[model samples]
Target chain A: MTVATAGEFGLISRVTARLGAASPLVQLGPGDDAALVAAPDGRVVASTDVLVEGRHFRRDWSAARDIGHRAAAANLADIAAMGARPTALLVALCTPASLEIAWAEELADGLAAEAGKVGAVVVGGDTSASPTLTVAVTALGTLEGREPLVRSGARPGDVVAVCGRIGYAAAGYTILSRGFRSPKLLVEAHRRPQVPYAAGPAGALLGATSMIDVSDGLLADLGHVATASGVGIDLRRSAFVVPEQMRDAATALGVDPYGWILAGGDDHALAATFPSSVRLPDEWRIVGEVLPASLFTAGDGVTVDGRRYTGGAPGWDHFR
Target chain B: MTVATAGEFGLISRVTARLGAASPLVQLGPGDDAALVAAPDGRVVASTDVLVEGRHFRRDWSAARDIGHRAAAANLADIAAMGARPTALLVALCTPASLEIAWAEELADGLAAEAGKVGAVVVGGDTSASPTLTVAVTALGTLEGREPLVRSGARPGDVVAVCGRIGYAAAGYTILSRGFRSPKLLVEAHRRPQVPYAAGPAGALLGATSMIDVSDGLLADLGHVATASGVGIDLRRSAFVVPEQMRDAATALGVDPYGWILAGGDDHALAATFPSSVRLPDEWRIVGEVLPASLFTAGDGVTVDGRRYTGGAPGWDHFR
Candidate 1:
C-alpha cells in the first residue's frame, strides 16, 4: 500500500521498526520529541545536507537503499572531514504521499547500514508530505578533544594526499546516462560512494594540516582549501592510478579518464595535507604539494603539474 | 536577483551576512564542513523538522521571514520540550531557482531573530535547487546537568497544566483560511508562534513528571504523553479561559472556540504533568489530571470532562 493509505504515523512505525538498535552514544533513541546523545568531548560537531529527488538522485537509476546511502554519506562525510567521530544521525524526509511504504523502509535500512560502517546510528527523524521527495540529514560527531582539521590550516610546504576512490562516480554517472549498466562496479559507485570514513581521524592523528571531502570535484574542493588557507595547490597528473576496469569503461564511454579524476565529484574521498616531515601512511597516496598563493593570479589557486587545468567544467554548483 | 542568477555560493554569502555574530557556545561556525558547539553537560539534545511549500506554509499568505520563524520554532520547541537550553541551529534550504534572493535573506533574518531569543545562532547549513521550496532545520541544545523531562515519566496522580497560548494559532489559521485578515493578532499568531522558551526548563526545575510541546492540539499531544506514560488524561473544560479576541473571532467565524482550544495545533505551548504537591509557577495554569490507563478504552487515552472529546479531527497528520 502507498504511504498515503498507511498514513504518517503508520509509515513512521514501519520504517523505525526496520532500523537496528541505536548507538550507545545515543542516550535516548526515537519515540521522543528530541534525542539526547553523549558528547564525551564536551563539544559536538554537526553538519546538515539536503538531497532533492531529480537534483540529487533519480529513483529509476538507483534503488531506495542506494539513495539512502548517498544521502547519509553526504552529511557523514562532512563530519569525518572535520576529523571527528560520527555518533548519531537525524533525518527529515519529505515525500509524495503516493510513494510505497516499502521504498521508505528500504531507505531507512540503507541509512542504518551506511551509518553502521562508521559506528553511528540513526537516532531520530521527521517525515512530511511534499510534491518532490527530499531527504535532509543532520550528522552529529565528537572530536575526542583533538583540534578540528579546518580548511584554513594548510601551509605552503604541506604535502597533499588522497585516501579514497575518485572519478569512479563520474564514470558511473556517464555510464548510466548512456543507458549502459553492464559495468556494475562503476554503476554502484555512482549509486553509493565508498567513503573512507576512518581515514579522516587517521589523518588528523597523523597531524594533517587541512582536510576536505571531495564532493564538488577534487580541484573545486581543493580550491576551497587554497582560498581559505591562502595557499596555492599543484597536482601531479601521474599520481592518480586509474583502475583497469575504469580505463575500459572510460574507453567505452569515449572520455578522458584524467578529466574525471580531476573534475569528478560525489565520491566523498578524503583529501588532506600534511607537513613535509611527516611519515605517510600506506593508505594515503601523495598526489600534490601546497605552494605560495602569490605565485598564482588572484582567485586562481589550483593547477595541474604547475600549469592551469585544461579540463572541462571545474566542479558542481547547485544554482548555476 | 533570483537565486538562479546569483548562484549557490552568492546566495549563501548574502544570507549568512544577514545573521548576527555566532553564540559563544559555537566554537566553529559557518563556512566549514561542520560546526563545533560546546555541549557543557556532556550530552546534546537534537531535533529536526522540515517545512514544505503549500504544505507546512504558503508563500502567498505568510512572508518569507514568518515562514522562517515558524520553521525554526517547530524544531526549537522540541529541544525545549526536553528541558534543554538551545545553543545552535543548522538549516538545510531547498528552493526553486526562481526564488528571489531577498526572500532568502529575509528568511535568514527571521531564523537568526528566533534563535537569538534563546541565545543560539545559525552555525552551518546547506543549500540546494529544487522544484519546490523547502526548509529543514536542526536544533541542538544542552541540559546543563539536569535530568531530561521525557514523555514517559508521568504517574496517575499527577496534575496536568499548560503554559503559553493554546488556541491562538488555530484561530489565526481559521481566520486566514476564510480570506479575512482584519484581526492582526490572530493572523500574526498563525504566522509566528511565540513559544515559552524558558518555561520548559523552569517546569523541569519545579519537578515536572512529564512534559511535551502542544503541536498537535491540547488533547492530541496530551494523548501522546498518556500513551507513553501508560496513563489517562482528563481535562476540565471549565479550566480554559478563552481570550476575548479568540471568542470574538470564533463567533465571527461561526465556530466553537473550545474546539479550537482542544483540537488546534501549532501554538507550541508547553504541556506538562507535575506532582500534586509541587508548587507550580504563576505561568502554568492547572487544567487537567492524570488517571489510570484502565479508566480509558484501548487507544483512547484522553477525555474532556470524563468523556471522549466531541471536537472534530484530533490533530494533524502529514499523510492521511
Candidate 2:
C-alpha cells in the first residue's frame, strides 16, 4: 500500500515497529516528542548530511534499501572520524505522497541494519511529504573518556594511515554510469558501502593524533586535514598499489585505477595521522607522511610520490 | 554570486565565518568532520525535521532569513517538547545550483539568530545541490537531571495549560491566502513563529505530567497526548475566547475564530498537563481537562465544550 492510503500516523507506526527495540543508551525513544540518549562521557559528537533524490542518488541506480544503508553509513562515518563510538541516529525523511509504504519499511530495515553494525540505535526521526525524496540523518556519538580526534592535530612527522578500502565507490559509479554489468562487488560497494565501524575507536586507542572519514576521496579529505593542521600530506604511491578488485573495473573502463583511489568519494574509510614513534596496529596501513606547510606548493596541495595527481578532477564538489 | 560560482568550499567558508564563534560546549566545531559538544547532563536529546520547498514554505511568501529561522524553530521545538534545554543545531541545506550566495548567508544568519535565543550554537551541517530548496535541521538538548515529560503521563485530573499563542499562524495563513494585507503582524506570524522555548523546561520544573509542541494544531497534538495517555481531553471553548489578534483576522476573513484556535498549526506553542492542585504559572493559560479513557465517546476524540468539532479538518496530515 502507498503511504497516502496508510496515512501519516499509520505509516509512522509501521516504521516504528520495524525499527525494533531501542538501545540501552536511549532514555526515551520514538513515541516521545524527542529521544533522550545517554552521553556518559559528558559529551556528544554530532554530524549530519542530507541526501536528495537525483542529486545524491537515483532510484534507477540504487534500491531503497541501498539508499537507506548509504545514508546511515555516511553519517556514522562522520562520528567515527571524530574518534567517538556512535550511539544513535535521528533521520528526517521527506518523500512524495505516492511513495510505497513497503519502500519506507525497507528503508527503515536498512537503516537499522547499518546502525546495528556499530551497536547504535535509531532513536527518533521525522517524516513528511514532499515533491521529491530526501533523507537527512544526524549521528550522535560518545567520546568514552577519550579526547576527540580532530582534523587540526596532524603535525609534521606524523605517519598517515588508513583503515579501510578506498576508490571502490567511484569505480562502481563509473561501471554503473557506463552500463557495465559485471564486477558485482564493486557495484555493491558503491550502492552500499560497508564502513569499518570499529577502526575509529581502535585508532583512537592507538593514539591517533588526528582523523577523518574518507567520504570525499583520499586526497580531498586529507587536504582538509592539511589546511586545518597547517601541514602538507605526501602519499606514497608504492603503498597504494591498485587492489585486484578495482583493477578489473579499471581495465574494463580503460581508465587509471589511481584516479578512482585519489578522487573517489563515499568509500567512508578512516584516514588518520599518528606519531611516527608509535607502532601502527595491524588494522592500519601506513600509506603516507605528514609534511610541514612550508613544503606545500601552489595548486598541488596533496602529492603522491612527490608529484601532483593527474586526475581530471581533484575531488567531488557538490556545487561544481 | 551563486553557489555554483562561489564553489562548495568557498560557500562553506563564508557560512562558517557568518556563524561566528562556537559555544564553550563545542569542544570541536565546524572545521572538523563532526562536532564534539559537552553534554553536561551525561545525556543528549536529539530530533530532526526536513522542510521541503513548496511543502513547508514558499519562497515568495517567506524571506530567506524567515525560512532559516522557521526551520531551526521547528526542530528546536521538538527538543523543547521533551522538556530539554536546547544546546545545539546541525543544519543541512539543499538548493539549486543557481541559488545566490547571499540567500545562503541570510539562512545562516537566521539559524544563528534562533539558536542564539536559547544559547545554542550551529556546530556542524551539510550542503548539497538539488532541484529545489530544502532545509533539514537536527537539534540536540540537555535534560539537566530532570525526567523527560512525555505524552503518556496526562492523568484524568490533570489541568491542560498552554504557554504560548495558538491558531495565530493558521489565522495568518488564511489572511495571507485571502490577500488581506492589512494584518501585517498576523502575516508575519505565519512567516515566522515565535515559539515559547523556555516554557518546556519551565513546565517541567512546575511538575508538568505531559507536554507536546503545537506544530500540528492544538486538538491534533492533544489527541496524541490523549491516545498515549489513554485519556480524553475536553477543551473549554470559553477559556480560548479568541484573542484580539486572531479575532481581527477571523472577522476580516468572515470565519469563526474558534476554528483556528482549535486547529491552527505552526504556532509551535507548548501545550502541557499539570496536576489540578498545582498553581499554574502566569505564563501558562488553563485551557482544558483530562478525562478517563472510559469517559471517551466512540466518535468524539477531542471535544470542544462537550461536543464533537464541526470544523472542517481537525489538523494537518502530511500524507492526507
CAPRI quality band, candidate 2: high
Q: Per-residue alpha-carbon lDDT of model 1 for A237-260, expressed as tens digits?
A: 999999988899888888999888
Quote the chain B TM-score of every prediction. 0.98, 0.97
DockQ of each candidate relative to the true complex? 0.90, 0.84
Q: What local distance difference test score does each model get? A: 0.91, 0.87
Error of 1 at B7 (Å): 1.2
* Candidate 2 lDDT, B178-253, residue by residue in tens: 8675477777887888999998988899999999999888988999999998999999999886778778778767
Q: Report the C-alpha lDDT of model 1 over B1-320, residue by residue, as the tens digit.
A: 99999998889899989887767799999888899999998999999988999888889889999998998898889989998889999999999999999999999988998998999899989999999899999999999999998999999999999999989998998898899985888889889999998998999999999999998788878988999999999999999999989999999999999988998989999999999999988899999999999989854599989998877877778875
- Residue pairs with backbone atoms closer than 3 Å in model 1 (clashes): none
Best by DockQ: 1
Model 2 residue A290 CA deviation (Å) reads 0.7
Best by TM-score: 1
Q: Which residue pairs of candidate 2 clash?
A: none
Alpha carbon lDDT at A85, candidate 2: 91
True C-alpha contacts between chains kept, each model in order: 0.92, 0.89
